[model samples]
Every structure is written in structure tokens, then in C-alpha cells.
Target: MRAKLFILIFVCCAAALLFPSMPGTDSLKTVFRLTDEPNEVIVRGMSGSALTINISFGDEEVEQLIRELQAPYPLLLLDMEWAERYPEIVQLIKKRNIPTGLLGHAGMNYEQNLPLLNEQLEKYEDFFGTKPLWFRTSDEQFPYTLRNALWDIEVNALGSSVRWHTGEPPPVIEGEIISLPHHREQRITLTDFRKLTETRKNKSLEDVLFNMSIKTKKMPE
Candidate 1:
């Protein structure tokens, strides 16, 4: 009982720090466990898979990738540098309602880079005429200062792998922010990812995920 109580306390603290303005551990943990199961009732309600790609550098490839995906893609533009290269692409993303977020690439040092993050957030809003809903740093760990800053701005936090090395569950809520893992528990190969993205238009995300599950089980580790 003591161990369970400690875990509950730890989860609540972690959730509060990592995801601000979100619900408590009881609800969040349920969601985390739900996300862990692919065919669970919670997952099957919508029956779909989603992907997020963080853009660390600038190039025409970024534009091409956006052109392929219509919406629900959290494109984390690393810096303001991409503004010049993909101005129109950014505009297109806004037009399509594709979720745009910021990435802390330059070490994402909250103390030192806070100014940079603020500047880019303003510029992005100006560029797209809308603010971003999410903010993600390069690393999985969310610093105290950064987490509070994101909460203040009402931007959600998106980071971490779906599962931790110690086998802890993913974070479900913070405040207005959500602590999400980019990958799922069921690992898929690079080839599977490529196939899913490349043929996204031709197939629904659920179909790809289902197919990938089958392919992965057949492969020898």
C-alpha cells in the first residue's frame, strides 16, 4: 500500500510538472494505459493512428512533407530560420488546420533560450495568423521553467517516447498542455513508417497501423 501511494504521488507530481492545466493522475493514467493497448476499447472508438514529425532544419523537403499530409500533423518547426525557407508552407499549414508547434532545438535551454522561443512564437503567429497549440523541446525531459512558460502561454507539451525505459506509463495530462509520447508501445520498423507515410493518401491510418502490426509480428527480432 505504501508503494502504491508513493507511485500515485510521483505520478501526480510528474503530471503536474510535465503537463500543466490537465487533469489528475487517476484520469490521465487511464488514458496512458488506454494508449498502450492498440485494440482496446478506448483506442477503437475512433480507430486511427497519428504521427508527428519535428522539423529540425529547413529545406524544400519540409514543404513536400506537409503537402503530403493534410491535417492532424504536429509539425514542430525548430526555429525562425525556417520562416524564410518555408513561408508559404507555413501558410498552407495554417490554411489546412494542421497543428503547428515549436521545437527547442538550440539546446532548448529554457533560461537562456526563452527569448528565442518567445520571438519565434510571435513570428509564427504573425506568419500564419494563428498561434501554436503545442511546444516540444528536443529532449524528453521537461524543465520546470519551460513547463511553466508553456502553461502560461496555453500551449500543450508534446514529447517523450510512448513508453519509458523503466516501464512507466506515458503522461496523459498537465494543464492546458498534454504530455504525449511520439511513438507507440508496439514498435514499427523504418520500412513500416515509410510505407505508412508514403501511402497515407491511399489508405487510412488505421489500415496502415493494422498492417504494420502484422508485419512486425512476422519479423524476427
Candidate 2:
């Protein structure tokens, strides 16, 4: 059975703070200073959903995943350091045209400082030729300061609207980006290499994502 899902889209609000300007972001501070809050609105809606999975890359089964998850089930997130160490992975990713994003900082709340955020952005942008279209903090967090920094760089990310991997709590429509949360009774995830090597699944993960995108589009906002 496909579960019902909600997509939450919200805004980023910037406020008064003294932040150090970074080399590539001289205009960022002034960009947010002009507005006390985001001019965007949050929209909530429901959808008939698919049994799709959105997996983040971990430090395992890199080659196997590359062989399997091309095109439809594209790679999503990888820690910046992993991307640096295995630069060849990026080449594979480019060939597949997979959309990948940077995982967040090592610890909590550094997005308040422009230079600190700049460092993270510079890492991926240098390689990918653009800032990330998606991002996630240590946890699936979206603190106000983090939102401000992400908004400055035109980054859009999705976070679990409720708990990290649970599928119960309704999404709270108050954050920087649109999050479409799907419910699957927890399995060993696609990122779980040990489990993938063990179990045999009937449906391909690619079909799940494709069906999901279609179903979600049909849902009225």
C-alpha cells in the first residue's frame, strides 16, 4: 500500500547580526539585510505516493551503487570529504547526470558566519560549477541561521518534516525549502550496503522514485 504524504515548503528569514564577509560572498550580507524575513510563503498539500527511497551515499559499496543507481535513481548526498577523497566518483556521477549535494558541517550551527558557510559552499561549487541544489545539516536540521546562509546561496534542500526517519508526525510548514516526506516502514536503507548485498528486492529503487515523482505531481496543492 502506498502511504499518504505531505510536502512542506517555507521561507528563510534573515535578521540583524554582524558577520564576517567572505571572498565570494561580498554581496550576501547586504542581500539579506534589506529584508528582515523571507518573502516566501509555505504551501502544504497531500499526494498519493510511491514506495520510493531517497538514499544518501555512505563510505561503502561505492562501485556497486554507481553501477546500479544511474539515471532514475540518481545519487543524492555525499559527505564533502568523501567527494574529495574519491574524486573519481564525481566523474562517474557527471556521466550519469546524477544530482548530488553536500552534506552539512561537522557539528552544530556554523551557518551564522558567512565565511564558515562559504568554506562548505566553496568545496562543492569548485567541483560542480555551482552551489548545491540540496543540502542537509548534521541532523535533518534547518535552524534559522542555517536557512539564511543557504538562502543566500540559492540552495534548496529537503528535510524529514518530522523525526529523522519516522513517518508519522505531520510536516510543520515552517522552513527554507519544500520537503516532500514519504513513509516507508523502515528497512535497512539503500545506503545500507550489507543489507543490499544480502536481501533480494522485487522492485527496483528507480521505479519507486519515478512513480513517486509522478504521483506527487498529480496531487493537488
Candidate 3:
């Protein structure tokens, strides 16, 4: 009886080692969850010597727009819906050779957002002559289905280290990605922002991502 019990225990242990229980559907679904925070890989790829500033632009006032465009080599996050109505501004951005990414709206479910996102993506490609590598939603949460679709195409859903609202001054911290969203009543200026971090190096989105060795669909000309 003791010999038989030992054999049974050995077989059970071997079976458990060889064939683990499958993960439940819920566990699998968690793999597709979207986050509004930078992943470890992104944080690790950042430069320890510089701060990366991301400025969100869309239908901003002329003075504010100019200030943002002139800020220290920021990654301009433009809204596609606004871009559709303002081609001249888009052309100006192209001429200036600023590094840019897409900014989107949230709140809709997957079904409603999918078509809108597709249209925006098409417009972006048409405007920039290359596929975008990054996207950010106005709201923190992005729909899981759209996130999955973006992942399939290798587009990174970016999250910032600090999000600068209008009234407050843009803070400077090395090795951080600061997102400056638009507010019509924004009071800060380029001079004010520069005064804080003028000593540190400034880099574009592409600059940091290149450090990670990510391959895009095509390099934007």
C-alpha cells in the first residue's frame, strides 16, 4: 500500500509539472487592458540627462499656439478632428519639422470609437505621409478594443510622467515625459516654461523612442 501511494504521488506531481491548468478567460482578458501610465520599457529607455516635454495642441489661441510651437523641441500632440478643419496649421507644422503624435477623444465604447479612430488614422497618414507611432487620448482611459488594434499595428499608447494643466507652471524633472494639455485660458508662456529647465537637454518623441530601438512603419520624411 505504501509503494502504491508513492507511485500515485509521483505521477500527480509529474502531470502537474508537465501540464499546468489553463488560464481563465478573465485572466487572458487582463492582457488586453489599457493603461494610462508609461510601461517599464519606456521608462527605462528615457535619457537620464534630459526631460521630454509633450505639448497637446488643438484650436488654441494664436499667441498660445505660437508659444507652444516654440517651446523647447516638444512632441506636438495634435487632434486629428481639429487638423481636418485646419490644413494650413498642419502645413505649418510640417514646414517647421516638429516631431508630432496623435491626440484622440475618449468616452465612447469600442463600437463608436473604432470608426472614429480609423478615420482619424487615415487622415493622419494622409497629412503626414507616414503612419503615426504614438497616440494619446484626452481622457486617461482608452477603449480596450482600440488599444488592441493599436498594439497590432505597433503604435504605442503613451502616458506621461507629469501632465501640466493650464494655470500651473510646467515643472521640470529629468528623465520624465511631461504632457502639457491645452486650456483656452492658459496663462503660462514659453519664457516661463524655459526658465525652469533651460539647463537640461531637450529631445523629441522620436529621439527617446529611437533609444528603445523601435521600428516604425516608415521614417517620416
Candidate 4:
């Protein structure tokens, strides 16, 4: 009995030393929240530094310009309003197999349009044959109420900022959502965005998109 007890204690000690629990004893639930706070949380968890550029120009000329530049970038947050007007452009992007995110306007709150939003999201999933990795509300305003609706759907919210230069630094909220400043020329090519995943070997697919917005750039107006 004495020998058995000694062996048990040794085993326990070894286990504790090898695998310690996190500092906070609380269980971490991975629910997606559609708030700026959640966005901040996701950004904090991103390990490798990545870059993101917002292609906000609605003019086809500008898009053509972008394509002409053809810099190796991974993700593009296409303006939904613009894409709605020219859905064919979105289809073109899809054909490229480039990951694209839709950016909504300030008044497009998830709370006001929960049913529609849910339906649209479902349709998006169906249309893409794969769920979108990133979704943003109000390119200018942050939608705080959207959190409740999206928490269950596993879709994260992207934060908005008025001024790129004077925004708060990204915070560690959780690993599901992230917020970023809105700078016109802040740019990322499809190649750089993919490179981000290379550095974060342990992160899930959702986590990569959640944190993508954290790396924003300031462009000259």
C-alpha cells in the first residue's frame, strides 16, 4: 500500500508539472460575439504580424487598377454596397478562389435585421459552398447589439474606426473577433494574407480571419 501511494503521488506531480492549467480557472467558451469588444479579443490572440487593406472604391476602374497592380494579397474586404451593385465582380473574385469579406454600412445593424442577416448568411454559406471566414458591420460605425444574435452562429464581428491614426490599440478579448481601424490605403495582397496562416500553425481557420483585421495600415488621403 505504501509503495502504491508513493507511485500515485509521483504520477500526479509529474502530470501537474507537465500540463499546467491556464491562469484563470474559468472555462473558456468559444462563442462568437458580434461586437467591437469581441473583435478586439480576437486580434490579441494573433501571433504572427499580418497586413490588411480595405478596397473601398466602388468604381470598376479602381478594381481594375487593383487587379492591374496584382500584388500578392490573400484576403479582400469588398464593400458590400458596391458588390451589391456589381455582383459579377464578386463572382469574378470567387472564381479566383481568393478569400473575400463583405463590409456593411453603419445602419446595417444585425439586431434590426436578424432574420434577414441570418437568411443572407445562410445563403452566403450555400452560395460559397463554404462559410465566409470574416464579416464586418458598418464600415464606419460599430454595431454593439449584433453580439447576441451572432454568438450562437459562430460568426465574428469586425470593429470599425473613424480615424485610422487615433484609434485604440487592438485588445485581447477572445480569439473569435477582432476590430481594426479604417484607413483608405491600408492594403494586403492575397499572398501576404496566406502567409499569415503559415506563421500561426496552431490556430483554427476561423481564428485566422478573426485576427486578420487587427493588422491595419494608414493611407494618405
Candidate 5:
């Protein structure tokens, strides 16, 4: 009797310990997150005018290769600092009526330089006849400083969000800024981009503008 009692007690203790509570399994359903949902906001172009392949010097081969790209595929995404040094390139591009975009490296802590940035924007407009379509602190990192800097700039001054290396979508802001997908190089054939632009015409600019404003509000402030 004692042996049976001992066996029962052991079994009861083991069961209690093993099944302390009903095992709850977490749902592992993965969902695709939309970074850029198709909305009323129709960004005008498809192919980025040019891929921001290189911003610094010493890549002569790359620059040459970029120049060899077909006409209308003007290599416009250039470094602001590089443009300052090679103003001739800017002039040449403008003379050709190529759509160029400038990426400025105002640094991550760029909030303090808003005034300077605004002045620079005016200078660009004066030189290029229009402000660049995009501006970001850096090409790789997206910290709070970059966000603050972007917020400080006039809504219409910049074009697209800076490409982040993290593959994370940029914090949406008011305007038709192209938020590139992560790891996706901003390079595309003129033919392909042209197709994208053609399709975009189906949407009105006002719709695109409204969507952009809505997206900006959704971003974490």
C-alpha cells in the first residue's frame, strides 16, 4: 500500500511540474508590411534620373561608366560637396536640361544647420533653376538628427528621402520623396523607369501631394 501511495505521489508531482499551465503557442503568422502603398500621391518619375553610385572622388572608373549610360539617364544624384568643387559639372548638366538631384551630407547632427541648409537650397535654385528633389544627412544612417534636419527644411525644398542602408523605409514627409527599398540600389534602366513614370500619370499630382502629407503624419514624430 505504501509503495503504491509513493508511486501515486511521484506521478502527481511529475504531472503538476510538467504541465504547470497549459502551453500557449504564440501565432507565428508573418505578414508583409507595405512601405509605399499605392495611394493618390503619384510620384512623377519612374527611373530615378541617376543612381547615387558614388559621391566622393577616386572612382574615376565608376564615373566614366556612369557617363556612358544612355542619354536622359543623366547621372544627376551627386554629392553637394563634389558639386561645389566641380561646378562645371553642374553647369554642364543644367545646360543639357538634365534632371539632377543633389544629396547633401549635412551630417547626422544637422538640426543646427537648418539656416545654412535653407541658404544652400536658395543657392541651388539660383544655379540649377530649381532646388534638388532630395536631401538627406547621410546615405547610410538614419538617426534622429537626420529626421530633425529634414523636418526643419522647407517641405518643397527637398525631393526624396535619403536612401538608408538599413533597408527600413524612411519616415514619410510631405512631398513626393521617393523612399527607396533597403539594399536596392537607385539604379534602373531608362526604359524601365520611363514605364514607371508613364503609369504614374494615371494619378494626379494633388493626390500624390495629399498622400505624402498623410504619410508624414503617420511617421513617428
Candidate 6:
């Protein structure tokens, strides 16, 4: 009876340790267990004044992004399929030193597609000559299991703070990460994006992220 009681206590303690009561604050904290819900850590260490646009790679924005945008490349989210389809464009993006991130499937059943992520990462490295550190799973349910897997590989799961589509008023530049879905039929064009940038000014993903790193270090322990 004592042994059984001890085992029960141990299990309860373990559970409490692993799953503490959700904090009331909005601070960035890592999830320790499997969860299908979106968590704050997806946008961990994010705090900035300048807005960042993550462009979903498409043919329409190629000229605008490469030549028009000029310096401080906007973040481009690319996948293996798109890379294969437009190798020359990919090369152009590379030559221009545009910041690119790995784009995941629309609705990935991670249990089955987990291995596929690894394969894509390998191909991404081969094509880009560097492993992707930023990953975007477009409006998909990102399970904690997958997030943990990504974190294990030193890759961060990114969340878009605002999503802007064409024909709508520009999104207010309040969030750190703003998404411009160029891949969609009705998406924000470079013309629209430039006007928005002119209003508030935008920063590169690298610059914003580097700022985040500095903010995290200075945070109170």
C-alpha cells in the first residue's frame, strides 16, 4: 500500500512539474508537452519598432522584391516545390542575398509528414548553402510535438502577427511579423507594400531578430 501511494505521489508531482498552471502574463515561454494549440513561444523573443514583411514567394513579386526593394531584403518563405519550379528565380533570390525561410505545407499531419520536414531541410541546405533557421506553417495547426522537434534542431516556428491581402486597406504596422501572401490569387503587391513601408518604414527580418536577441539578453532573470 505504501509503495502504491508513493508511485501515485510521484506521478502527480511529475505531472505538476511538466504542466504548471498556465501563466497569466503574455511573456514568451517554451511549451514542455504535446499541444495542438498555438502558443506564445512561436513568436518568442519578438519585440521591435519596425514591421517585417514575410513574402510568400511568387512570380509576380520577383522583379519588385529583387530590384525594387533594394537593400534590407524582406523575408521570403520558400518550399522545395517552389524552388524546383523556379530554379532561376531561386538563384536570383540567392544572388541578391534575400533572406529566405522554409515554408511548410498548408495542413501538415505532422505524425506522417515529420520525416518529410527533415528531407526538405536537407534539400533547402543543398540549394541555399545554409540550413533554414526560420520556418512558417501557414495558418496550419502547429502541434507542440512538431514545434519541439524544430526547436531541437535550433529552428524557430514563426507566426505572422498580421496577414494582408490585396484589395484591403494596408494592415496597421503594429506587429513584429507581417505576412504578404504573394502566392495567393488576391495578395498584397509590391506596390502596396512599398507604400506601406514608406509610411512606417520596415526592417529586415535579420535586423528585427537580432534586436530580439539583444532584448532577450537584457530581460530580467
- How large is the C-alpha RMSD of every model relative to the true structure? 13.8, 13.3, 15.5, 12.9, 22.6, 13.0
Candidate 2 ranges with C-alpha deviation above 4 Å = 1-60, 111-114, 161-221
lDDT of each: 0.44, 0.42, 0.53, 0.43, 0.39, 0.57
TM-score for all predictions? 0.50, 0.50, 0.61, 0.47, 0.42, 0.68
lDDT of 1 by residue, 1-221 (tens): 23443464466667877877674332222121212212111111122333445554545555565566644453343445656566776677667656555655433476566777687788767775655654556554455566556656656455522322223333332111112222233333333434554532322322322231311111011
Summarize candidate 3's per-residue lDDT along 148-192 as a digit string, tens digits: 667665566765656553454454554556666553334345565
Model 4's TM-score against the true structure: 0.47
- Regions more than 4 Å wrong, model 5: 1-54, 58-63, 71-75, 140-219
Which lDDT value does model 4 have at 80? 48
Model 5 C-alpha lDDT per residue in residues 56-131, reported as the tens digit of each score: 3323433443455444332345555566766766665556544454455544444455466666567667776655
Q: What's the true lDDT of residue 119 in model 2? A: 79
lDDT of 2 by residue, 5-62 (tens): 1120001112222333333232111222211233221111123211122333443455
lDDT of 1 at 182: 28
lDDT of 4 at 37: 31
Question: TM-score: which is higher, 4 or 5?
Answer: 4
Candidate 3 has an lDDT of: 0.53
Scored by TM-score, the top model is 6
- Identify the candidate with maximal lDDT: 6
Point out the higher-scoring one by TM-score: 1 or 4. Answer: 1
Least well predicted 10-residue stretch by lDDT in candidate 4: 23-32
Q: Ranking by TM-score, best first?
A: 6, 3, 2, 1, 4, 5
Report lDDT (Cα) of residue 210, candidate 3.
32
Better of 4 and 5 by lDDT: 4
